[model samples]
Target chain A: MVFHYPNGRAYDYHKNENHPSLVNKVNHRSINHNRSKTIYGNRGMSLEEEINESNQYYLSQGIAVIHKKPIPIQIVSVDYPKRSAAVIKEAYFKQASTTDYNGVYKGKYLDFEAKETTNISSFPLRNFHAHQVEHMRACQKQGGICFTIVKFTKTDELFILPADLLFKYWDEQDKSRKSIPKAEIEQLGYKLNYSISPRIPFLKGVDLLIANS
Target chain B: MVFHYPNGRAYDYHKNENHPSLVNKVNHRSINHNRSKTIYGNRGMSLEEEINESNQYYLSQGIAVIHKKPIPIQIVSVDYPKRSAAVIKEAYFKQASTTDYNGVYKGKYLDFEAKETTNISSFPLRNFHAHQVEHMRACQKQGGICFTIVKFTKTDELFILPADLLFKYWDEQDKSRKSIPKAEIEQLGYKLNYSISPRIPFLKGVDLLIANS
Candidate 1:
């Protein structure tokens, strides 16, 4: 079938599909997701993989449409072989100004930064950059859903902290010279329950935030 | 002045303060940005340069908090020198499933795909991917503002066209036939006027669309 464009142009999705869409590669093997080694288990899912799976589940359920933004990389060189995939020879890590994931949920723009820390005491605000904090502030000012998904690696405890709180601490960080305590977090923040599918289950906190708002 | 993070780590952001954010050695000038090549004899700024300037404008005017998503890349190899910047030795292009730009605009969620085409006759749907169309559909369903900025390279004409029309043609494109024509686009698209800084003043069109909606 022919797919039409916004500019009124049409193209065949099946034509020259090899170079672009792997529409033909729809080989769905039994989705026993190959769990990575990051989870410190033989075959447990990583936090990112669980989120991706949760996103898929959410998409299927029509509850929300969200996806993690790819980590930005600055490429310096690429070698195009005659018959194989192009190999990048030289590149650099590009600093990201925004959070790791964002999307539309329940008609509201959702913007967030996800982070995991091995520390047990406090979720380090150091994981976030000044620009991301600024980005969240801008989003919050305009009534967007702004928050962060913080994971305490050792405890495996996750919390959805309001960006407002984050910024507040961010501003006073220089004067106070201390991290936001986990006990303080437990009082002010909403603790997220983990699940097998969407491991982080942070959206539940967003729902709670919206309802309260 | 030392800006301390929420985690008690401090950073100095005073112009040339030797802050890498990512690492100690990675310099500020490295991630600053690539100066885009000027296109026309009119000292024409590239679409990228214009977009960055527009983002800056958005920040200053308090109109929006939009940013271009970084190019997705897959890292294959890396080199860590003891005394120099870490150089990525190999990588490959990873497919992007969403639009290039997305963020908060006037308390509303905004999502869009921007492309510049040299062909004025008919903008090619090939420039956009099927997954992106699906992504836009997903975002639109959630009430996010999604659209495409089509730039005709010859005349430097930029058009802000909504994704609804894009979806219509994208669906029809699945048929076993032809692409959509250019004349239909001229009628449907909102031609964007160029300006000194942002060049393509798209938010104006977005405002008109928003007001009507």
Candidate 2:
């Protein structure tokens, strides 16, 4: 597929044109995709990149207004340029307290964080911070929709777990548990599948949660 | 007022001990505050600082969860110290497409931009950019509550103007009008009065807007 800019430049829509490693990963999945043409081939992309692309798709379709908050940077020094923009000479990345993505969908405030794990059996409890949990709890109390989108990279399965349910397992970690098993997540969360255009259709899982709630 | 940190250090809430010019500005307004005891003593603080302090008060009281989005920066180079955190060696400021503050309040998604102007009679249209207006419009279309908290620096008056009203004035700028007069704003917007603790009680204006809506 080809898209043309207003300036008449053509943009090729070929996959992994810029990243050879991503292309290699996609080629490896070609066998599985060839067997079942219905499933999406989300090969080498990180969960964050896939969600960001999904968000762009959502924005274009007027479905939602979600966005990843930019990483916060603590600026130390800036040099005033003689004939150009000011240059930040020194800075450092700052730790964030809340979740990654947030926005409004059909009058509901949506707040969520996305995480991925290689272990297919369970997701590590250490993936989330205490401050993030507190932030989600506060947002949930204010009637905002709060959840975590966890992806099992080994199995290529995604699930959206409610913040309250996540809190239940999180609070029990000190009692001897370390991770949330895949079976428990399957029982308590809504699973999502990728599609062609908007690769990660996580909002479908959100809809199910909303309907059940 | 003095705040004590967890480390047992006292933080003095005095104005501009570091910036002498800012202290002078505050001293210039001390005479006016003495005459009008009902007004807030926001003498030296920038509009951004006042809004941040107000947001902190709201957060502490669990009234709302509004937060200023950090300024985005484009990182160019980084230096990794062996035992310390990675330091950003070079970067540049990135333009933001959305407003500065947003949060969930009473099951409603609240989005707003805070702006201050020294102009006493009218708010200059140049204070706002085209992209920001588009962003506010998009949020409003999705049923998010959108507005602008404008501060008249000379008069020390604050008003919360609905985004729809702002759009009307903004669109007329192409027709030669460049500012929204104070009288017009007073007629269409909600004026907020400061209270003791939350120096800028702008949420009172939000309450009025909610009631009317």
Quantify all predictions' global Cα lDDT against the true fold: 0.66, 0.71
lDDT tens string, model 2, B37-86?
A: 45545755556667778988887888877777776666666666665666
Name the TM-score of chain A in model 2: 0.79
**Which predicted model would earn the best lDDT?**
2
Task: Give the per-residue lDDT digits (tens) of candidate 2, residues A1-213.
Answer: 122334553322123234221121111222333446444456645566688889889888888888877766666666655656666777766667677788888877888988767787998877787777888887877788899998886678889988877898898989968888889889989898888768888888888777776
lDDT string for model 1 (B1-213, tens) is 122344553322223232122112111221222323534521444455566678778777888888877756655555655655556777666566677788888877888876666566877676677778888888888888888877676676778877877777777876732333567667876888777755556889888767766
The recovered share of true contacts, given per candidate in order, is 0.62, 0.55
For every model in order, what is the iRMS?
A: 12.4, 8.1
CAPRI quality band, candidate 2 = acceptable
Interface RMSD of 1: 12.4
- Best-matching candidate per DockQ: 2
Candidate 1 chain B TM?
A: 0.74
Looking at model 1, residue A63 earns an lDDT score of 77
